[model samples]
Structure formats: structure tokens, C-alpha cells
Target: MTHKIAILGASGYTGAELVRLIATHPSMEIVALAANSKAGMAYEDVFPHLRHLALPDLVKIEEIDFDNVDLVFCGLPHATSQSVIKALPKSVKVVDLSADFRLRDPEEYVKWYGGQHDALECQAEAVYGLTEFYRDDIKNARLVAGTGCNAATGQYALRPLIEAGVIDLDQIILDLKCAVSGAGRSLKENLLHAELSEGYHPYAIGGTHRHLGEFDQEFSAIAGRPVKVQFTPHLVPANRGILATVYVQGDAQAIYDTLQKTYADETFIQVLPFGKVPSTRHVRGSNFCHIGVSGDRIEGRAIVTAALDNLTKGSSGQALQNANLMLGEEENAGLMLAPCFP
Candidate 1:
């Protein structure tokens, strides 16, 4: 069964990524491309790397006939997606790659995103699309919310440990480094070649980062109490991937064993050999997340590191995984491509 797909925000990084992955998918058809600013331009013209594939010309959101689209991948920015998805026909299943529907509590959305959710009804029905942890819910959801790239990376490193009760919840810390592409295809003075190429620095320090809302909501639910981790994100000069180094008070071997045993049967998650670490370069351009654990020289501490392409496993690929479930297709369909290596 072929599913007709529409990609909103088609000019952005994650949108192009969705196109790249779906280009090779046998059962997914790209029926529409929507990018308000780039509307009426050929999709290949916006992303020349996709020139070899046949795709529709980009159009404004209003131009799309949702009735023909079996699935819509909403890659629009945070505040914009809520109103857009709420207006779409309810019959079209949606996979939203935005923060708008990720937090279940609309009040939490306001606290973190600084606005009341315009689509409260839609948000209520939206399933958190973490894929590994929320698979069953996604399978039955009409709208699935893709997790933040940093949030996804941090969770891959820490969720298993939290669930197993092997780690001290009070002392958790997550330090993350992400590629510039995760910032999106937008132009920022700081993202310029001269400004970013040679140096790397941290932003969203001191718990001000918005992804903390996701960490707070997800972790708190997992522990049945408020679990807040100190999180700091750094923007490194790269095109893809995120590496989260999580510090927790736990037995290193136990942390490694829990992760290994939990993800051993999972298709896209790989728990690296104990004491070895994973690198972002290894998982670039793929939907795979590689996690590793090492003992701290200081007693009662362990370092858990996870790496994945922030654009793929963290966003577009994750949306695809959820869409597969929504459409009754194989969960890994169109997402089994291996990582790109130099």
C-alpha cells in the first residue's frame, strides 16, 4: 500500500531530509511540497542535491489538498505548527516535527514556549513520537509529535538507566554538543562560515534551554516525581549529528548492562562496548543512535554518551518511523539506510 505524503516547510533542513529518505522508499509517494516563501519554485531548485529525483513544485500551505495526502509531515517551526496542523483535515494522519505538540500539558507549553497552545484539542490527541519508548501509542495516534533532537539524544543515553532504577535521579546531568544543521537552514550571523568554522561554543546555559521542558516532562513522568537534570547545549561547527555526554551517579557496569540488554533487540539503537565511546561522525546521516557507557575514575559515577544524526534519527527519520506505524507499514520502512561516512 503506497501512502501519499505531503511535506510542509519543504525548504528547511528537516523537510529536505524527509524528501531524501522518502525518495528511496518504495511505498511512500511525495505528493506535495509546501514552503510559503519558496512556493511556486521547483523543489529541486530549492535543494539541488535532490535534482535527480522528480518532485512537485513547492506551494503555499493553502495550495495543498490534504484530502489526497494520506500523511503530512509538519516540519514547520515551533509556534507555527499548532495552528497549521489544527486546520488540516482530521482524516490525514500527521507527524509534527515541532515543539508545539510535544508537551502534553498546554500550560507547560506556555511555560517553556511562552504562549498558550492554539490547538489544544489537537495537542491533546497528539502522541509523543519517541518511537522506541512510545511505539504503541504512535501506532494508534492520529498526530505524533517528534522529539527535540537534543532531547532524543539525551534520553537515549539516560532513559534505560532511569527505567532500571540503577542511577541516582537527583544527580543526573546532560551535556550535549550538536551540529549547526540542527539550528535549521535559517541564516544567523553566528552560523556564518567565518564565525563558526574554527571554534565551538555553548549556548542555552544555566537550564534556560527550551528542550529542558521535554526532559522535565518525560523524565518526571518516568520517575513519578520531578526529575530535573542540569542541561547545557553547545553548537559545534558541523553539518549533522548530536553527542550527549550524560553524567549520573551509578555503577558503570550496571549502567552499561541495562542499556545493552534493553536495546539489544531494538533495530536502530546500538549500545557500544563498555568503556568505549561513540562518535557523532559514525552515525551521521543515518537513523541509528549509538550509546556508550564508561566508569568514572571517581567512585560511584558513570558517563553515558550517545550520538545520532540530529536531522535524521532526531527529526525527519523519527517522523518517518512514527508515520510508518500510523499507516500500518513496517516501522523501519524508508529508514534503514546506513550512515554516511567520509
Candidate 2:
């Protein structure tokens, strides 16, 4: 029952994270590691923290032998994953960490991503990888698209309320702050230490952030109507985690009760005691998501906060969760490690 896993783009943060988690998975093993730019280098050379593990030397995606791989983690960049994944062996289960197959509609893909989906067939078959809501679908999907870190954060706060009909559909607003690591390992002018430290700024304001497509698609489906929220994402200097504050119009107590009841049986989602908010530090390096609710000054409104390590629950850990479902293993296996604390 051992599953052989390959990580394409292993030099990146999320890919490195996949290696870290899979290193402990009882049913999975890392058989191939691909990093086009870092090809032929030992994995430990690029990530010294992983020096203790026995891992494959980095190879280019085209050089991999998918015949022996049971699963592939596509951690490539946005437009890049589609083509790369389409080229992977059809029998290999894929958990794409990019935005390639996340949006259901091809038109929406072009609208948000600014190009035609290179793999329409794959897009059509890919299951949304929000493990809690799409557990059954993920279990049988050949391709699973991981949710956007920001999108996952907002949904954890609002999905239950929307599904239970306890909140106003038109009044949702998501204000999220994410760590720089969410930007990926690619070099960026703004992500440099000198520029990013001691500064933070909100980009993609006014419903323009690409993740809004996910929010609109999922929330609208839950409410059985078009549900668009005012979403703004800010880039912070920290290296990992996402903190989302959601504003919803609803009875404060009702909103709290709804979230608590909805997540009571879920292992990775934690609903904090009412009125007690969660912090990003509490969930860092773990797949767990912490949600807290409090009443706003207005009686009919409430604020819901959710926090999780963007690289863990937000990306790689989520990918692993879906892979477990695909492999028919325990949903939380290899993911029970507690969050790293300060």
C-alpha cells in the first residue's frame, strides 16, 4: 500500500513543504523531486533542513519516470502547472498546488488568470481540493486542485454560515493578510528583505484579487445564488501564515453557534470558544485552521476570524489531505503533527 509521490517544482516553499510532510507519511514516499532550474542538485543542498532525509536528486519534470509514481504534487507556477500536469502519466493521481485547475469555468479562468486554460480536459475533471467540503469528491478524483490560501482562509470563516442560511448573502467582506512565503520561492522585486520588512500594503483591492473567483464560485453555489464579497488581500512581511477577518451580517450569537456546530466533527478545523479570537502563530506549521467569532458593535453584524499557516493548511498540507483521500487512507494520517510554537 505504499504510494510513491513526486513533487514537480521541489525548490519552492510549497514543494519543500510537501517533502517535509510526506517524509512522515506512513503510506507515502517521495520517489522523485523535480526543479527545472535546480535539476541534478541534491534536495538537501537547496533545503538544508531536509538534509537528514533520504530523497531523490532534483530532476526536470520531463526527465521523471511517471511509470513508477503513484501520485504527483504539481507545485509549479500558475500558468506552468497546466501544461506540466497534462503531460504527466494519466494513471498518476495529481494534487496541483497551482491555480491551473481550481476554477471550474474556462471563461472564469481566462477572466481571472488572463489566458485560456491549456488543459481544458484536465480542468473539466479536476476536483476542488477544499478537503472538508469536497472530501467525497477528492477521494475519487484523478486530479485535485488545491484552494488558494486566501480563499481557504475566507471560506473557513463564511462557508458554514452560508450553508446554514445564517448570514446575509450580500454583506460579506474578507480582509486578509498573508505572509510573503505565499508569493512562492520565485524572486520578486517587492519580496526582497529590504523592501518587504517594516512595510505592508494591500493589493488587488475592490474585488480584483484572483482568489475572489473562488469565493464567488463557492459562496454563490452554497447560497444558490450569486454571492460576491468585497475582498482585499494585504502582503505582510512574515514568512508563513494567513489571517482573515470576515465581516458578515447576521445575529452574532447565531453565527458563532453555526460555526461551532459545523466544525465539531472536523479534525483539522478548530472553532475557538466564542468571543475568543485566534492568532496565526497558534496554527503555524500545522494543517489545522482556527476560527473565532465575536459580535460587532452593531447587533446584526459579527466578525469572524480564521488563521492557518499559508504553506501548511493553505497549500501543501491541504494537497496531502486530498492525496490521502485519493489513496483511501485516513484523512488526517501524516498530518497530525502539532503546530510549531514560538
Per-residue error (Å), model 2, residue 226: 0.6
Model 2 C-alpha lDDT per residue in residues 1-342, reported as the tens digit of each score: 899989998999998999999988998988899999999999999999999999989998888889999999999999999998888879999999999999999999999999988999999999999999999999999999999999999998999999999988988888999999998888899999999999899998777889999998999999899999998899999989999999889998999999999999999999999899999999999999999999999879999999999999999999999999999999998899899999
Query: What's the distance in Å from true for residue 294, model 2?
Result: 0.4
Residues 77-159 of candidate 1: C-alpha lDDT, one tens digit per residue: 98899999999998999999999999999889999999888999999898999999999999999999999999999998888
Consecutive 10-residue window with the lowest summed lDDT within model 2: 204-213
Error of 2 at 11 (Å): 0.5
Give the clashing residue pairs of candidate 1, or none. none
lDDT comparing candidate 2 with the true structure: 0.93
Q: What ranges in model 2 sit over 4 Å off?
A: none
Q: What local lDDT score does residue 179 receive in model 1, on the 0 to 100 scale?
A: 96
